[model samples]
Structure formats: structure tokens, C-alpha cells
Target: MDKAPDEAKEVYSHHGVIVKKLEKYNERESACSSSTFISFVSSGTLSVLEHNNDRWLLWVPEERNLSVESDPTEWEVVNTEKPKPPSINDEKLESRKIWINVKDLKSLQLRRNTNKMFFDLKDGTTFDVVFQHGDAQQFISSFRSFVILERSRRSRQKFYVKGCVNRELSKSFAELDLFGEQGNLVARFMKDLHDRPFETTLTAFSKLTGVVASGLSNTLRPDDEMVSQPSLQGDEYEVIPSTLDHPAMSLPPRPTIKRGDPLSVEEWMRHVQEDGSVIKVDTLLMTIFRGGIDPVLRYDVWKYLLNYIPYNCSQTEAAELRKKKIQEYQTLCQQWRSITPEQEDRFSLFKDRKSLISKDVNRTDRTIDYFAGDDNPNLESLNNILMSYMMYNFDLGYVQGMSDLLSPILMLMDNEHDAFWCFVGFMEKVMGNFMLEQTSMKEQLLQLACLLQILDPVLANYLNSHESGNLFFCFRWLLVLFKREFTNDDIMVIWEVLWTDLPCRNFHLLLCIAILETEREEIMANENGLSDILAHVNSLSMNIDREAILSKAEAMYMQLLSNAEQLPIMACVTLGLPVPPDPETGDHEEHLKLSNMTPSDDDEDAFEKAMSHTFL
Candidate 1:
């Protein structure tokens, strides 16, 4: 184990630490690589000290005088960019060192099959921290806590500035040089050190000071009567004045919109049309995953999502493809319906599948306006699409919950051909869920159970006592993608986000975990049996919060990454991550854990912070 600095500044520290830097990559690319490394000081004792409540400062000693001791409080910043001085010169002076703010960190990522930890920075720098597994875990936990405290401090600071700005504004501004054209100089300094977005930092400043654009004055007339006059447009535009607006102050920079908010219809369409003909797939997916598509845009967005329209095709090409698909669908349907009564009867399985399809179509989402009523044409069309789907894929045929999946697609794409093709694209992603043997569904349940076991051992054991260990209760959610658990609008939101396939694969499973975690306290407190748990889960139909599910699901994804090494093979496969090879057999090992825990809100906050650091 690597020892702490001999002359410690802060009395105590986590030992056996190794640190290395990451090679740069495009922001959109993976963070799995750590090729570049930072060398440690060869002669002096390395130190990790509490820089403050929110940061950890690392110091590397330079000169060697055994009898002399250095003060912990005295430290110098090491600029790694500078060239090494002459070897004859004091080597200790050139020793590498840097200060790390806990909140400014991106992630503490572990390289698979290695005992190395990567400390990622918000400015796209990654450093490998070499430590024993146990020590690394402890250090990471403490670091994570400091990060949380820093975030909480930031939130409080936003309000704290608001609380006593009157007394401090003038004095603090002058002392901080927050005057004239430029705004708060202190904010700029803090922003550079923290490496957070300027908009985010500025928003906090604005909230504290109650100023919009700098403390500059507005030119608009004060009288409310002239506020709406049309002639005052352009250069003569009216500006709303406020208390902080002074003639001596210059205007503040225009505020940018929150990056993580859902894409509006205008933004969605403009992004899609940006490349003119070919759509930017990564850009589109990133936008969707950040928040989700607006409801109004789904009608057009669903085509790209379902792959009914090729992402790289031009507007003219898409139109041509759609026209061609329509003909093919009609032709396929015409042949199926043209079969003589005797010919159709000869195919015994067709009749059985058709009977099952009719039953499911009628039983599914009858309360929704789109599918409601005894003799509705929409319902009739839905039946036709399902039957048509069966004809298109005779081998798979009509399954029980297939209608549930098809209903929403049909509802959104009212055109018969488009609806059928969109459902086909959706089915491609979910085909395993509909298999008669349910091989995929069984695997998913096993994965979910394993995740619960690792994340919440207590919950897993409790579930075992109640005979719900197999997680059969989540079958419906996996099968139809939780179509039954939310309103039409909410379901669309969920589906669109899922279609993005961002962050990770099998996000729906994480969503199921999120929903389960939400109800954990209820189940645990009630001492609920498997039957009670099942009933409670079923009762959650149409009552789930779409935003809450997305948020929690994202948190679970981060938590999964946090403990990636200990994860089972199935869990790794479910999350689309690489599985480590076993030492004994020279093959990847597969195992399962039998525990579960309900994630707290802090997980989401940490996940958001990590994401901002890594991607922003």
C-alpha cells in the first residue's frame, strides 16, 4: 500500500492512493480509455489534505532535508503544462500536484478487470488513482459525500446571497470588481476554478442579486401605458426596469436556456432538419435522452424513432420510402384478406391466432378515447393491423400482449401502412418479450433480480420470504414496455425516451427497478407477501409518474456503473457493458446476487452531477 505524506498537513487521510490522467476524447465518445498518466514525485512524501469542506488538495514534496519539516498550510499550484526544469535543479520543485474540487469532478470510474480508479474532471481531464480495492472504495465514498455537500452548499448559496444582498452588494461588488460592463468578477473566478457552466453560475448570481442583465439600466418608458405600443419595436424596444439597473452598470450577458430540459417542438424539428435531408442521429438521441420529445412533435418524431423513415434520408427520400412501404403493406394485407374461406380454414393456426388477437384488441386500453366504444373504426383498424402483423410474421403470429403494444403505435400513426411499419420497428426491439417460451423475458427478470440483490440485499431477502424472488410481477412491464402503467401521454413520453437508447441499453429494466424502489417502503412496512406485492404493482396502472420514473431510472444507471465490477454477467449483459473474464477457467463468469435497496434522491443528484462533469 502507498503511504500517506510523512509530514501530514491534515492529520488523517485514506492511504494506498494511485493517481493517473486520462487521454482526451470527443465528448460524445466513451470514457473507458485511460492511456495517459501523471507521474508522482520520486523522493518526497505525497500528501492528500482537506483543502476545505468541499475539496481535496494533493501536495508533492520537493527538497529533501530530513531534519526540516514543511508547513501544511503553505502550498503552490503545479502547472503541468510547463516543461521540466534542468535535472540538476531541485527536482522537488517540479513535482506534480493539482487541487481537485469535489463538486467539479465528473466520476470515479473503474477500469474493468483492473485495480485502477479514474478520477474524471469536469474539464475533460481523467486521472487514475492507484489504491487497494478497499482503500479506493473508502476514498471514493468520502469524496462522493464531499461532492454532495458542495452541491448542497451551492443550492444554499443561491438563496443565502438572496437573503443578505442589500448590505453586501455594493461593498462586495467593489471588492470583487463586479462593476461596469463586466458583472461579478468573483463569479468568473469561481466558475473557472469549479469548471461549471457559466450560465449555471450566473443564474445563482442573478438569484442572489435580483439583477437580470448586469446591474445596467433599461431604456424603456416607466409608464405601463406604453408597454405594449407597437411603434416601440426594434431599437425603440421597451425594456423592463428593476431596482439594480443603474446608468453606471453595463448589461449582463443573455441567459441561456437549461440544457437538460426537454426539447421543444421547434428545437426538435430544426435539429432534424439541420443537415437538410439526413438527420443527425446522435444529436437527436442526445436531445431526447436529456429530457424527452415534446408531445406535439411525437407524430413526426415517432417515424424516425421506429425506423419507419431512415435517419440519413433526405425529405424527398423519406417520402419515396413511405410511399413504397404503403404499397407493400397494402399488398401484404390484400393477399391475406383475399384468402378463400376454405383456404383460410385450412390454416388452423391462423384462426386460433386471429381469435386470440380479437380478444386482446378488445380487452386492451378500452378506456382511452382512441380505442373506446363497441363499434369504433379506430378499434376496427387496430384489429386489422394486428391481424396484418400476424400475416407479416406468421411464425411469431399474434401473442397476448401484442395488441397492447400495437394500440399506441396505431393511435399515433393513424395511417394504416405507417402504423404497421412503426409497430414492426418497435417489435424488432421488443421481439424477445413476445416469444412463447419467453426466453428473453426470463433473462430480463433474472437480471432485474440480480440487480436488486446487489443493490438491496435486504429487499431481495424479504422478496424471497414472500416468494416473489423470481420477479414475475414485472412481466407486464417488460412485455409491453409499461403501456398499462401510465396514461397515453405518459406512455408516449416513456416510449420516446426509451427510443433514444442513450446513456445505456435496457433502460426499461432500470425503470422497472425505479418503480419497484419507489414502492419499497410500502412493501417492506406492510410485510407484504408475494401476492400482496403483485396486487400492489398491478394497482400502479395509469398512476405512475413519468418524470419520476425517468429520474430514478437514470440514478439506477449511475449506481450500476458505480459498482460495475461486482456485477453479475447477466447484469452486465443487461446493461450492455463488458463482462470480465474469470481467472480460473479463462472465460467470463456468470453469477447472481440476491439483494436490493431503494435508491434515495441523492443518487439522482450525483448522477446529474457526474453527467454534467463528463459530457457538458
Candidate 2:
């Protein structure tokens, strides 16, 4: 006969009990009652379910036989708003919630004698959960390990190395030159422990803690050699064999760009076709890949990159198209400016948009010479163009960062009509970033998360472990394509190259990866939390070396190509590149390219030529 399942074992068990406070007053009990019982949740079972990519859920059921671990659609959800203020006494001033986030939990303590568990939350509220004696011990033991592991994960960000000594291991591991290896293992161990709540995780956490605590206790002089060793008797300081070999914890080499590398007008001239038309998209892309266009040539080159003038359009044809586009822009502007207050009142959205546009135009790039000074005509010009854009695309309206994207284009173009049209063309590439409901931003961030997971799983895991896997830190970077991160002149150069759309599509995403690559070591070294990482990235504004970013981004693109077979499908889709061959049939799947498909030359000669030239 088959053995019966163990009734004592917790497998989404029948029910668990929790006590909630009551709101109604009772004269006798309320006279001295510090807390009132609202309802006893005796029909529910507690289960942990993975929520978004970065967080887990501790759900309670309302009725028996409810499968909390099943589809999330079936699970009762909460708004993700901040928890309510703690009550002076545990009173049920509100309706009961079926679940509370594991993230909001600050601590969990158990009173073994009373078989009750107390949950201390980040919002300063406490909840009392009661269970039978046997169930209480098991729940406390399991949940305690989870809390300790989470604390250690978050605490990792605070400790940093000083003078080559690992903060966690102190001088002992440094003397042995085991800091890097041991640190990596512990990170992996922590990651593994947090991924699931099992007996194995508890066992691993116990061992990992002992090892980390032992390492933390050591104090060794700089002169101490490996031979002069000290021991903490009865301490389990040995590394866990399983954690030492995690492949994801190994850090990749940081990207680098050699000095004195900037593309010049002379090299750019070399790639122009004989008819004065731009060369094949590939050749122009190669030219602009680094050392962006010279300032003098930016105005001319930008037209082709922005596709205001087609790749093969002759000078005569461009002049004709320019006149027509000017007329087109004026017509659109006049249509909006002609709108009387009477018509605008009927369409409240239009009025609201105009007000928002006025506020943004007043602030956009006001510090720059082009838009500065009292009643600057250029500022009015900026305002007019944005207001015209509102008329051109009434649906998108105006987002806060659109001004940042348009500022450089206006600076490069000579007239309002030209600037307006150029801004229109530029928006085609990035407008999705400003779309309603943030659908595009979410998609891009998800794509970025996928790329990071492949390139650096350790960093990716750290971000997810800290509930920051959404990659919202990259919002500004993507919103305006790093417009705030560089100066006006530098932005002109960067924008023109990005317009080329060569090597791969969505090259901006690659640029994001490139920037992250340069800072990966420091990020890992500091073990920065989400806030620190966001601050560090935002602080990089105006300090970035554009050429280095381009170089490293190029290098990363090549690396992805080299490892195409192992690349994730979403990455290929994001890059607008074809998916690699299927292992079974050895057949490749074709994808329609979203951006310019022209392949750029990845030769070293251009890099060499750029480095050799000295700008006069």
C-alpha cells in the first residue's frame, strides 16, 4: 500500500488563524479594553507566491480550499499603496485585508509560550497571528530564516571595502586573497536562499551566516601573512561547496574606449557619396559610430540622420522638400493658434495641454544662451514650436521631457519651421516613450531588464532581490535619450549618430548597457541599493564621456552578436535583429526590422583614422 501523506507537513494546509481588532465599541469591554477583537480568520491558510519579477506575496485566503499559489488573476490583490498609519491600539478601523506584502515586513517575532507571531511592518503597524503550538513553531522557524536572509541582502549595500580590505571579511580574507571568491560565494548563497523558502534555504542560510559572521569577526594587521593564521574555535568558517561555483556571480570585464578617439569632419567627408548624397546607410553609420559629427557639419548631417532629407535626396530635392515642410509646419501651427478660447473651452484637454506646454516652455533649457535672457525670441520660438506640436499630435499631448528632446534640435536648425519639423521627425523615434499609460516605457524597461539579466545576472539578481527589477532608474535616460546627461553640443553629436540607426536597432538601449558596464565594478563593489544606484546614474549627467559611451556600446553590440545563440528572444526583438537558429532544426526565424536595417562597417581602420587625426 502507498504511504499516506504526512498530515503534519505544511502543503498549502487546510487553514490558519489570525486575530483582527473590532471597530464596534463595547461598554464593559471597552472601559478597560486596550484592544478589541474584530474577527478571527480561522478559515484561511497562508502561502507565499511570487508576485512581480522583483517581489513575493504572503497571501491569506478568505475561504477554505482557496489555492493562493495558483494564478494571480484568482488571487485577491491590493493597490500597492503605502500601508495605513498604525493605530494607537489594534482596532479594526478598516476592513480586513487578505494579504500583506513581504516587502513591507520590517521584522517578525514569535512568542513560543503563547504560540503567537507578531509582524512588525515598515509602516510601523503590528499584526498578531496565532497558530496551534506545533504549527506556530514551524511557521516561526521558517519565517525567521526568511527575515534574516532579507536583512542580510539589504545590509550588503552599506558595507564597502576600505584600502583593499573586504568589509565583510575584514583583513583575514584580504591576507589570504580570498575576498573576491568568498564574497561572490556569499552573494550567490544569499540569492539562492531568497529565491525560495524551503528547508534547504534555511539550512543554507544558517551555514552562510556562520561563515559570514566568522569572516566579520577577524582582525588582522596589514603585515600579517597567509602563514600566520588565527582560528575561531567551533566557528564554521569554511565555504559551502555548492555556492562557490555559481556562474552568475562572476563579473564581466568592464568596457573601455582608448583616449583621443573622436570622429572628425574630414573622415565624415570620406563616406559621402560622389553625388553629394549620403553614402549607403551602413557607411554613414560607421562614420558617425564614434567621435560624432564636427560642430560645423552637424546642421547638414543632422538632416540626413533625422531623415528630414532622405539618404539619396540631392541638394536641390532637399531644398524643395524643405520649403514644403516649412509650409506644412506653419499650417499646423496656424491651426492651433487660430483656436479661439470659445473652441478651447469645448475641448478641455486642449486647454490643459496648452497650459502645461506654457509651463514647460518657460523652463526648458532656460540656462542655455540660445534660450536665456529676458523675453528671448528663441524662448518664444521654442514655445511656438511646442504649441504647434500639440496641434500636430493632439493625442500624445505633452510630457515633461519632450522639451529636453526638442531643445537641441531647435538649437541646430535655423528657423522655427525647420526646428518644428525636425522635432516632429525626432519624436517618431522616441514618442512612444511618452505615450499614454506608459506602455512604451514599461516595454523598454522590461527589455532593458532582460538585457541586464543576460549580461550580468549577479547585478540583475541583486536588483530583483531588492525589489528594483523594474529598472525605473533608467527612466530619464530613456525618456530623453540622455539629453540631461550631456551638454548641448554633445547632445547634437549623439542625436545625429542615434538617428543613423546602424549596427543594431534601438542602439540607445545598447548605450544604456554601455554606461552600466563602465560602472558595474563600482556598483558591485559598493553593493548599492536602488536609491544609491538611481542617484549615481542621475549624478552622471553632464560628466559622461560621450565617445567612451559610444565605444563601449559598440563593443557590447559585438559581444551580443558573438553570443547570439545564447541571447534571449526579447533582446533580439528589442535590438531589431534576427533571432538565432533553433538548435533542433538549425533553422533561423526572421524578424521584421523596426528601425533602419542598413548594416554598418565594424572595421578598426575608421577607429584608427579617427585617433590619428588632430583637430586644428
Candidate 3:
């Protein structure tokens, strides 16, 4: 009981704990001539050394086991094995485990239990190990292992395993008393037990009592992101721009921030953390594209080009282009296959059959296709097209929509590099949308509005009158590069036309304007609300006949491009971000309100003083 607070001057101390073998339980013959080296058959019952020096280990061959409990979850019963003694050597110190750090996990096969006297101790009536604090004299100032005569007796103590009965062992590890300056470390440990894995070698201690090592793995960093379900998976991040025009148009002009107070890191972190499926998909696609492509494709080059586009293409024509690309991709795989099956052509293999971030994905061979009838070229060729293109652009590592783009391309050209070049060509204009910086998305949306207004000002007025101006709901469509808007097959057609740069860069924006035009009159006739109008536009995603949409979209592209100077200059350049304004709102008032809160502390203090009455 005197060993309560681990850091009190009277109780804090450190002791190296280990299980020492008292006597041999099941004896067997030795194999290796070394005095400490021992080997036994599959079944081996061995005694555990209850006490050992500061650092300890066991030795065994890779095939042999250090035999913990047979059933890991129920570690209470140690099934007796026919133990054999190994030729013991005083020591020939060589171990792979100690070289690599595994300070916390209880069960591992590091292959050192051969000569060492360490074995499973399933006698699980649990308790802790406490040591008393003492000065160097080992007497005047005391803190050391002090056990009352009643607990362990003169020799041994018998134990039985059962359900938890919180029998307090006053002399337990958690209840330690200590004294002095290192109190903070002890306090931190007690406050956050999970952090123990990072600091202590308590893994072996828990294993000695058959306790599960569940609480031993945790990070102590204060600002780490907390997840509902922790993953064993590691973390990686890569950002690339988006390519491909969407039905939605760009945003209008943005208001300035006006040299005011900027948001703090915490504010920014908080703002971006409330993510959506778009974000989730963003992370997934980027991860796959990163690995699925050549590893060298990482961070190649960044370009912000706006390639001009033309108009007048049909959806039927787009579909034909997709079929062509898929055929081209298949032919590329055939060429690579002819080189060798040595798997050396790093440029053209599926890094793995599984999707990135999938829990079931094996850590082993990621490139082999498991689902396509053992090993099919379809998935392989698809990976080829992806990796090839990822290598080609390098600027856009691969956005989520790129996969959608690639899949349809694979169906069309099928030859890796050729399909890749087409995707790269298509992205030259639309890629800005995928930039982390929202340039393309907002600009397209704004331009879409201008196009719509130019064509049918009545609907544009209806939208303006109802406060439904910016049309932000089309965000997903633009961000995903229209991947979500069209059916799997139809996306191929739309993308092919987009790739041709025909109907020019603003064609996609015109597509949206066309959609709004068809639905605009209906929207203007009803004064119920703008929600329905927005919903109506978004609903046109897959339902809009591709041929009609493309036809109208092309016509609108011509109408705007032909009247080039009249087109709205790209919106949002004023604010320096790609986000649009609420069609009817302005940020000037908000900026002014924020301005009042930015007085310096010194000025604030002086102002307070001046406000106080002199008489007071």
C-alpha cells in the first residue's frame, strides 16, 4: 500500500521485469551442440524463467514456435506439449527481433526462443508488479521491491484463472508511489494508459498474466485525427488537378477579402475536415492512381493550361470514340505481353487487383487480377492505360474522375499508351477543375450562367429573381468531372467529345446552360421556390438524353465562342479562389463586419482605458 502514487519521493522506482524458469517441467533431448541452443518437435512444453535481467530474449529456428497459448483469444490454457531440451550455449547473441522494434505486440515469431527459457504462463489470476522508491544507499531513502511476507510465501504461490473479480493487489504496477521532478511523465502515463505502448515494455508483462494486449497501441500526439475505427493501414497523400468539362458552368465574380484578419490553422483544419463522399472518393482515386501508375509518376509536373475547345459533336459519335480507345488499350497490353512474362515491365501492370483502401486487400501481390477468371488481360490492360497516362501527364497524378475516364477509355481503345494520350489531350482544357484550387469549377459554372443568359435571358432572370443564382449544387458534377452524372457507358461518349477539344473548352458549360434552358421555362413559370429548380437541373444528370444534351451543348458552345468578346471574363479572379458567390449575395458586408474584430491587443487595452471615466 505504501507504493501508491508512482512518483512520490517514497515510492517511485524502476525495475526490469521478466519471467524466470524455476525448474524444468517437461524434459526432452537437445539437438544443437551449443550449451544454450535447443530444438524440439512441433509440440514443446517449457518452463518460464520468472525473473531475468533488464533485457531478455529467446532463440528458435524460423520453423519452430515459442509456443504461446494455442487459442490466442483464450490464452488461459497452455496445452502441454512434448518438450525436448536443446543443446544450451552460454550464448552466441544473434537475434532478428531485437534488431527491429516490436516493444508492444505480445505474439510474434521473431525466432529466438530456441535456447532461451521462456514459455507460456497461462496462470491468469491477474495482478501487477510494484517497486518501492529508494536512494542509492538502498536504505536511508527507500524505493525498491518490497513485498510483505504474506503474499508469495517462502517459495511459490498457486494461482487459478477465472472471470475478473477486481481483487485489489495493493502492490500493483498502477498503484505506485514516487517522489520528485519526473512526476509529469508518471502523471501522463496514468492519465492515458493506451500511450503505454509507446513508452513501456509492458507487452511481456501482460502476456505473463494471459491478459490481451488490446490497450497497448495508441498515439499520444495531441492533434492526431481520431477515427471511429482505427486502421492498421499506413497513410499517404498526393494532390492532382482534375481534367474534363462537366455539364455545370463556372462561377461569377468573387468579392475581395480586403486585407483583413486571416483565419487560423485550427479554423482551416476544422473547415476542411467536414468532408463528403466527394472527398472520400478523392482520397481513394488518388491513392490508386498513384500506385496503379508507375511509382515514378509521383509529382511529375504541374501545368494550368486552358486548351480551347470547339462545338458540334453528337453523343453517338462520342460513344464511337470510346470504343476506339478501348481497342487501342488492349493492343498495347499485347505488345507488352510479347516482351516477357517476367513481370519486369513495371510500366504496365496492375499494382494489385484490389482497390486502394480496401481492408480485404492482401499485402502481397497487388498486381494480379483475382476476379477475371484467374488471370484475365482486361483488368491488366486497364491498369496499363492508367499507368501509361499517369506517366504521360504527371501533372494530374490521377483524380477520382480520371478512373471513370480511364474505364470507359479502356472499353474503347484497350491499348494502354494510345488510350492514355487521348485522356491527356482531353484533360488539357478541363484539368483545371481538378486543381485543389477551385479555378475550373467556378469559372465553368459562371461561364455556364453567362451562356444561359445570353441564349435565354428570361430563365436567367427567373433564377436571379428567386435568389437561385450561383448554382453550387452542380459542384459534385464538376468536381467528379461528370463521372457521377452519366451512366457508365455514356460517360465514354461525353468524354471522347471532350477530349477532341471540339466544341471548345466552354462546351461543357454550354451543356449545363442547355439543361437549364429546357427546364428553365418550367422553373420560371412556378414561383414556389428555387430548390425545385436546382433539383430539376441536378436530376437531369443521367436522365438527360446524351444525344440531345450534346447537340444543344454544342450549339450553345458555338453561340458563345462565336460571340467571344461578349463572354464573361473568367469569374473569381478578384477573390483569388475558384469559389463563386451566392448569385444574389455579396461578401463586402461580411468583410466589413470582420474588420471591426481585428484591433490589436494594445489598442484594445488603450481603448478600454479611455472608455473608463476619470473620476472612477
Candidate 4:
């Protein structure tokens, strides 16, 4: 009666699967449709079927003739047919059949609590499926049999197709013109391996072999070995290696500095006079640098640290400024809020930005109770602030990680006006990281590489020889200021400390150095290449010791100062220190502060030239 369903080889089938949510991408519109939650009691059957040499994950309503027996493992196929290609005109059929080619799957995220599995496709369509009868593990195991699925190191619930990842990597490497038109450096090197046998080539090969062996070992490792080992905790901190281990390097041993208690309410009050003018600003900054401001004082201290309130403003002046800022923020918000449907139709860029902001805000920090739950009002505040900011600085516009930076500020301030202005202040400090060209970000990475060379030449050499000299692994850390690496509580402390800008400018780079020093042994012992290094660094997320890293960075700062004269001029310039006269010529060279250079300015060219010559 149904034209006899096309016969196909069924690999696996699971019944009682329900489509909880569906979000489809409109190819003509170039935007995703709003997610629609399915409420009707429509149970479905999910099957992995092979047809025409391709595997597809097909889901069809159980109302169709296909049915599963009471055992759940046996299926009675009566009128089963391969789903036809999706069409824009047939809404009913589109909703009835959901087909995803296994090759197009970008990532899969599992929610164990709700038995939900989110499928993210390369075409930007998403499906949230819930298992009404059983967990998703059986389906996941069946799917894994067709593709090499590797669990993401950063997110435990996420799995990526190894083939897709490898293809992307291969494409990227192919695009790089490393050795110019002559030939690809890697290919040329390999071809002449026997002829040259250069030490650098040998070292590169050794690293590559180690990376492959390590990857194989990890993939084949037993389940017991996959269990995480206990990490050092409590009062024990990682030991810093002796500087004397490297020849011709002489520096003071790392100092032991105990972190002080957070600035208390009484201490903070002593710093603020009765008139509300902060007294002894330098002392206050140092106190915050040594130990972050207390959580209770963040609401007040953050205003000063973020420059929302002038240090010299009295109580009355502060109140007036607050009122004025509120008016300004409202005006900005109204600019975006007042846009009509007719206007949005013509303003594609505006619409696109709004769409992106909406999506990012929806998922920003839903795990946190403050922003969790459906229809949370706080999520609206986040969206409004970011939208207003788009109007405030239309040129910069919205970027992906901007939400990560805003979530904490919103959580702490808990008010639109204060949080908006505080976020503005924070953006001003790190805006370069979001530039179109990312020039400032590259400069920071290079500066970090140069600093590493001065601090630990061995590690620097290892990275450089292994094609990781760019230090791109730390991009996320610098981009969002370690927001992803640390817990919300830890980031609250880390961000405030960084905002103080005490000890030195670009002290965040020093924190990177501290982390590398802590992990130097493992990195070197394992001979990690670029990929391995990136994986290792990413796996460090949420496990770093806040106080230990801060103390080590501060101690390293002091060590650099102790040996400042002997340090390279590039190192001195990077740290914002005055460069000494040339040792041989007894002449002073102009110092360029790398932290202040931006791509929009002419100094960027000078910065690039300086970096090139320093490395040469």
C-alpha cells in the first residue's frame, strides 16, 4: 500500500527516541530558525541505515509502519522506507523524518541527566533528542562503530569525529606555504632526510614520533588507566626547577612568597575616606595585587579598579556620576531597542549581530545558578548590555568570547548600569584581542615567546623546534583572560588582580610563564609536539592552582628585576621596563612598549620590525 518501502541494510535501530527540540538552518536566509520544542507525544525510531555506500542516522515517527517489539532490541519492519531528501515546501514530511549523514556530524554533546543528546552538524543545524525509554549510551556506542569518535579533552561530554578533525588539520597544513614556492618544508625535509640528517630535522622527527606514540598509547590505554590520577593539593605546590641547570644562566633561586588574605572590609574602609575618596591608592592597589579583594568588597572595589568611579570622586560626586552614567547607558540601550521590524529588514548587519548576541547570551553561563533556568531575567540583562554596547562601539561589534568576559561582571555587579559600565572598562583594556586582524594578539604571543626564551631557553627551544614558537596554545587564555581555565570563584579573584595592573604591565604573560614552568617537566619528558602541547595545555583547564601560579609569577617578576641589566633588551621592552645602555657601545636604545601597540596605529609596523630584528 505504501509503494513497498525501499529495502536498505539496517545497521542499528533504537526505538522510543523523541525529538525534544529542532533547530534548522535556512540556507536561503543564511540564519538558523528559532529552536522549537516538540510537545506532542510523538515517539520515534532512530536507526543507522546503510544505503548507496553511505551511512545515515534516520529518525522517523513511530506512527509510520515500523515498530519495535517489547524486547526493544527486535524491530518489525512493515513499511520502512528511506527518507526522501528534505524539501522547503513539505513542512509535514520535514518534521516527520530527520536524517543526518554520519559524515556531516561536527560534534555530539551528551546530557546524562536528561538522557538528551545534542547533534551539531557542519551545516549549522542542530537537534536535541531525548531518549524516552533508555539512555543514549547504546546509540552512541552504535554510532561510534562507524566513525572514530574521540572524547574532547576540554569537555567531557563532547566527542569529535577523528576523521573530520584530521581532514581539517590536513587542509590547514596544505594551505601553509612554509618554504615558499620552492616546496613544502615538511615534504622537502622528509625527502632529504637521509641526505641532510640535520640536528633540527632529527629533533623534529623525534618529536613527531613521540607525538604519534603518545597518541596511540592514549587511544589504546585500558579503562583503568584512563581514570584520572590524584593531583597534588592542600599546601603542596609544584617545585620550580633550578635556574643553574641550564648553562650560562645565573639568576636568584625562586622566592617563596605566601599569598596574603583577601583585602578585608575593615582594611578596605580604612583606604576609603569619609568623603568617599580612596586614599593611598598605590597601597590599595598593592593590597589587591598581593591578595584579591574580598567578594563582599568587589562591588565597591571593582568600581574603582575598573575606573567606573574616579579615585578622587567624593561621595556626592560619585552619586552624580552614577546618575549621569545611568542616563548615558539608557540612551545607548534605547538606540538598539527602538529599532523596528521594518528597519531590521534593511539592516542585515544589525540583524546578524542581534541574532549572534541572542544565541551566545542564551548559552553564556547557564550552568551557574545566577543565570540558570529557562526564561531567566538575568539572561535578558546580558543581551541588553551587549546590544547597547554594539551601539556604543558599533565598529568593534560582537565577538564570540566577549560573552565569556561579560558573564562574571554581570554576576558580580548584578545591576544593568553598573555591570554595563564595568564591562565597558574591561573591554577597553582587552579590546585589542578582538580586533579584526588580531595583530595585538599576535604581538602578545610573540612577546610571550621572547620572554620564554629569556626565562627558560630550553623550553623555548623545544617549542620553537617543534613548530609551536607562535605560542598559539595560550590564545584562549589571553583572549578571555583565563575565564575558561579557572572556576567562576577563582576567576573573580584572578580578574580583579589582573585589573590592578600592579607588579608590571602584561603580567598575564608572566602567569603563562608560571604555568609553563610548572608543566615543563611533563612537557619535556614526553617530547610533546605542537598538537600534543595544545592538548596538554587545554587539559589544564579548571585544575590550575590560583595562589600558587600568582605567587610564582610574582616571584618570577622579582627574579627578572634582580637580573634586569643582564636580560635582553627585548625582554626589558616586553615587561615595560626602561632599557639599559648597550653593554658594548654604551649607548641607549629607544624602548618600545609592546603592550601599547595596536594594529590601527602606525606603531604596529615598528612593533613588527622590532620583533623581527630581536628574533634575528
Worst 10 residues of 2 by lDDT: 157-166
State the lDDT of candidate 3 residue by residue for 1-616, as single tens digits. 1111222222222222122222233222222223322222122211111111111122122223334353221122333363634643435222221211111112111112222222222231111111112211232012112111111111122111111111121122223211111232223322212211211211111111100001100110122233232212113222211111112333333222111122233322332323210123233222222212121221110100111111122345434655665666566546534554345435322222113212111221223233135345655655555555544454444433454445544444445554465556556655775553233453455445444444665665556456454444454555545665677555644553443334244456665666667676677765835456545655565676666666666555444444443232231121122232223454544322321211133462432222121100
Give the lowest summed-lDDT range of ten residues in model 1. 157-166
lDDT of each: 0.55, 0.54, 0.34, 0.66
Q: Put down candidate 2 lDDT per residue, 459-486, tens digits, no spaces.
A: 7667655434545456568877888778
Candidate 3 regions with alpha-carbon error over 4 angstroms: 1-377, 387-395, 465-467, 480-483, 487-490, 522-534, 557-616
- TM-scores for all candidates: the values are 0.53, 0.55, 0.33, 0.59
Give the Cα error of residue 64 in candidate 1, in Å.
99
Q: How close is candidate 1 to the true structure, as a TM-score?
A: 0.53
Ranking by lDDT: 4, 1, 2, 3
- Which digits, one per residue and each the tens of the lDDT, describe model 4 over residues 409-520? 9999999999999999999999987764455665576567656766787887687666565565676688789888889999999999999997988999999999999999
Q: Which candidate has the top score in TM-score?
A: 4
Count clashing pairs, candidate 1: 18
**C-alpha positional error of residue 421 in candidate 1 after TM-score superposition, expressed in Å:** 0.6
Residue 99 displacement (Å), model 4: 41
